[model samples]
Target: MASTPVDHSAPDTAARSKVERFRANPWLALTAVSFGLLMVQLDGSVVAIANPAIGRDLGASTAELQWVTNSYLIALAASMILGGKLGDRFGRRLYYLVGIGGFVVTSVAIGLVGSIEGVIGFRALQGLAGGILMPNTLGILRAVFPPKRFALAVGIWGMVSAVSTSLGPIIGGLLVEHVDWESVFYLNVPIGLVALVFSAVVLAESKNSGGRQRFDLLGVVLLAAGLVALVFGIVKGETWGWASAGTLGSLALGLALLVVFGLYETRQEHPLLPMRLFRNRSLTTGAVMTLLNFFVMLGGIFFIMLYLQNVRGYTPVEAGVSTLPMSIASLFASPLGSQLTSRLGARVTIPLGLLLSGAGMFGMLSWSVDSSYATMWPPFVAIGLGVGIVLPATAATIIGNAPVRDGGVASGLQSTMLQIGGALGTSVLITVIAGKVGSSLFGELTGAGVPAGVARGLEKAEDAVTMGIAPVSGDMPAQLRAAVVEGSGQAFVNGLHAAVTVTGVLCVLGAAAAAVFVKGRAEEARDMRAQAEAAGEPVGVVAAH
Candidate 1:
């Protein structure tokens, strides 16, 4: 009888082993996905810094240089939703691998092409790949992580993104200065390789287990066309003039196509993006918050860089170095925001973050051509902390509210908003700066001791002044040159003040919207669980509370 005792411990041991494996799988998946995120973010940030070098080596014109960036933006913004749908329909891991692999290949191709045209074409392809890769990273995370741990995982992901973005200028400057521009593209190879390995080894394949859902071909065409038109208009608005027929026509057509697409989707049995998802207030609010937040963040960064380099005459490396406090603070703030969102809810945390960000922008109103580093660094830290806090909180709020089945689509929507917001921010702020400088240049120049005749002659230099560069020629008298320089700097600072003032106001309004709309943690958890249950996923899968 004693010898016949059952070996029940074997079953218990096996169960423990299974539990341990599942627990660790999420983090491993995070690691795998982050590489793709890192490569994409780093590439985007560094490429802008590398543009001048790219132009010099390839004998590119200004328009050609602009295309180098625009082609990628158009492709990325257009294909993002389609990419997510493809991943949702097929396998996220499959598309993800394909994406990273294509990105790597295209990046290499860009360096080897030896022509600006080829670089532009390859950049488009790279954007398509990025569109595919980005949302799936979130999709994979959404699938693997338990609801309880999702926010923290997303927080880490945000941290990685923020840090990489922050590091891009510095890295690009170093590589372009010391190495060659090609190195920036080649940098992706090793990172991609490691990502491929980890992803292949660790990521479990997941898809919408629906029975052979038909692809929304028409929806794809409409959405892509709509997005392309909209983004093209937004990107070109500053150059084409905001009220020009081209911009107005493109925007109108885009809106019309999107409206048609929405109607078409509502009729589809298995639509690319489920319109029903918008039924969740949290998702809608998160999306709006994402758009507005990036509008301020990216737009603000644009002018700051101009002020630092073009006005204050700092080198690219020095400007990047000055922003280190922001990077460091962001690293800390992301995780903290995640914890706060978990406990106090997005309603509290998002507004708090936005308020802090608004205050930071307001603080920057005091910056001048001769402003000290002490004044500069505090606002940088505040912005870093605020952006870090908002990034994850919004991401978690958006992705956490959706069912696992539609995770990729939701992720894509969020990403599309981000791209559009960034584009709008940069373009609109540029326009604002240019306009403000144009109107104030003559007055500022005359006031700064330049003769009225000379100041009137410099009216044509508003564009240069907007960029923080004075249009003084070396042939000019020393006093005149100094006056021109002083005037130009002041004019640019005035533009900066205008841009930040608008941004600060936007942040305040965005915060109020978030407070009114976003649900608390408990309510959000219940909604998530209910949605998961309706989708027939196990309730325990998202049991946040």
Candidate 2:
């Protein structure tokens, strides 16, 4: 839900009471908030370690292992819009605790299961819980934190979540190495339990009925199914063969469903996502920019993580640490977004952020087998700074521009776009990398001076080098495997360049869109205060679209 300033004494008193309760046992509240977030973050990483083990244990083919991750992400992207709406319609606190509780239970079940099918089923459940928690985590911060400190509170929460997710792969690798993959799932139990208890004690229950309580079930289903179809089409396209009927049908059907969703939403009395929100220039631009922006960042990270571990010959820990520079840069750099808006205005901020991001991606195209980590900082720094600037500036514009009556829908739209965008980005990158690996192996074999007759045996060797198969392929000879590694690593570097090139193109387009859509700051803030006054609500909270 979008944060709105309240003029009501009762609600303000209630907010103060919660704050006072927090001060009395700040650790408890902090623990509750952070742990709830931790479970959400942990799930993002835990599966990386389990991919191989799950494949082996379940007698699954390579396709099944990818499904294990895809199912969760698909559900998350699909359900998040509804999850945010549910929180607004019912209560954010209720959903927060329930979501975490559901997540913990499903995670334990996933770990205890011995079957691949069962694990996929439970992972879907976990994603449902995640969809709930993901949106509400911000809603909780908005409802609990006072107006003056809202930005700082949300910033800290965002920082912690980012750090935890970055650490997930490293932690998962350690647990699988030392104990078992199940330990990663088990790790969430304590954290989940603590969040549940402390949240019950310290966090006050809150909701925004906004004069509507009915669930938009039809709209929800249409949007969700559309996303799943679209994501499946992209994520599984390479593995399934992009030209295959299954892949094309999925994409076509997804497109059709989204069209239906738009048509139906326009007719509904209380649409899950109001079609009218798109009428606002800032809301439309902000949401689109976020979609395109995260598509680059999330996709880049997916490829980069794989490159670091699979191609660059780094351990999980090393990969995690290598990314720390971007993480740090993001924190120190986000407010530049606000500053850009304050000085040159949103028109300038949006385009500037996109240009910065695009330039960063273009710079990353130079990666090679001989690339150094020390040289990696500049591209990462640019991307990080670009993101930091994009999120808040777009957010200020989007929410600042949207109507109060549609705040829930507006918030849901932005978040849903983010989830769907991230899924698409990650899936697209995976698809691109996998496709290139097969071709790269054949090309490498051609270059290696190997005879065509020898490819039957040598192909496995040459292809292993090209396909990034060595991290898990332990039985190969050192010389042969090293050659395979050399070939595969180079292919991945090329994949990075392609992915980065795409990012740069999309970001530049997004920048142009932002320049047209967002409002000037003085006008935006004044509009927000005026809307608050008209609504008989508090001042200084929301800006008008």
Candidate 3:
């Protein structure tokens, strides 16, 4: 008797109100998207700090520890393009929701796993989920924000990424020191839940809305297999001996598969990656720059953390705290880089950033067994500023210059470069360190008065350091302990210097590539207009900052 007529306009009115609120304060939307991105970035770095503790608890060998990290990276790299395509074809919001849920579940599973193999498997699953979430973060931002404000939004996004990744070690260190290694993985559970709820509530649905999309199953398989083989060969080369049939065959097979994949994509009607995208020099250059940037930065960080803990006898917490200067510097430098890009363009900023990073890597050559944090922080700050500037600018360049229909693909490609570069960097640097240590450890130990028999027996010290274990374990003769400690420390420093030198050289080459290949803002705008016109879309600039 008390029932009234239904208000049919209520749903539409609520939807309109939400859209208006989003328009009024896009920053709120940015906050919502950035949370998921922050979680993904945090997980990438936090696990690095926990790797040693994980090995200790699970009794994982050096190769298994390397697999723990590489498996996640390789899986993410392999699936990222597919994830981006899925988001484009379906909806970004839906994929993002699934990604967050999967990531949370896997994180919990990893924490609960008892064996190293289980942890590695679950970590790979976590990476697959992350691959799905990451590209959508930028796609949604591009969808919501206009080009005028997009540069600043990207800067803010980069800042959140830099800060979260930078602080991951500190957070992980505290968790591992005070709680346990499992606590590091469990930390993601609450953060992920909060991000998932916020994303569902605050984010709007967006998709390509273009012609019908197609999946390339063969492309996916080839890429995944090729990358797995490549990374495996690089990671295991030291143990397998560079000249061994196993290592050489893996490398050759991976290269052949990749070559075939590239050729096949060129002929496909709807390729996973459009071969024509490479014609856009800015996009190509940006992708390469991102790859080189993370290669040097992440690889260096991996060894530095080990050096701090295993060589210098610092605890995980102490090692993490000592690197705060770099993180703090990056916090400020990111915004400054955004401002610089708005004025100077990526062509200039990117090269300058590379040069600065190269200088920082060269500075690391001065490191020694006796060097203190005081000597290290200056180089840290330099590197932080360099990465802070380079990463955001290149990200903006690639995404801004991309066509609207291809935003998700561009984002995924950028992410793919980053993960692949990081994986390769870690593998190559670890290999370099192992080679250097293998050659030098025996001589150093013998020179330090370690008997020839003991020196040969302690040859495993190279593996120990690579795995983040101290050279001298358990009680030993005082003289022998001293010899072993000194020898190990010196050998590690030598390897670190060699790795840093290679990084420095690569950074210089990256600068050259950026200068030559990245176009200016005016040219980039014209190119975007050309692309939009060719696609029969709006004839104005699609993504000019």
Each prediction's RMSD over C-alphas, in Å, is 4.0, 6.8, 3.4
Candidate 3 global TM-score? 0.91
Evaluate all candidate structures by whole-model CA lDDT and list the values in order: 0.88, 0.70, 0.81
lDDT of 3 by residue, 87-148 (tens): 76678778888888999999999989899999999999998999898887776776667666
lDDT of 2 by residue, 276-345 (tens): 7676666787888878767876777777777777677787667767877777766665555655555666
lDDT of 2: 0.70
Model 3: worst 10 consecutive residues (lDDT sum): 536-545
For model 2, give the 10-residue run with minimal summed lDDT. Answer: 536-545
Candidate 1 Cα errors over 4 Å, as ranges: 1-24, 539-545
Candidate 1 residues 1-545, lDDT tens each? Answer: 46777889999999977855664488888999999999999998889889989999999998899889899988998888788888777888888999999999999999899999999999999999999998988888887788778889888998998889888889988999999999999999999999998888777777777777778888999999999999999988988999999999999999999999999999999898889988999999999888887887778778888899899888878888998998898899998888888888899989998998899999999998789999999989988898899988998888888888788898898888888988899999999989899999999999999999989999898888988999988799999999999998999999999888888898999999999999977888788778877878852242111
Using lDDT as the yardstick, the better of models 1 and 3 is 1
Could you estimate the TM-score for every candidate?
0.95, 0.84, 0.91
Best by lDDT: 1
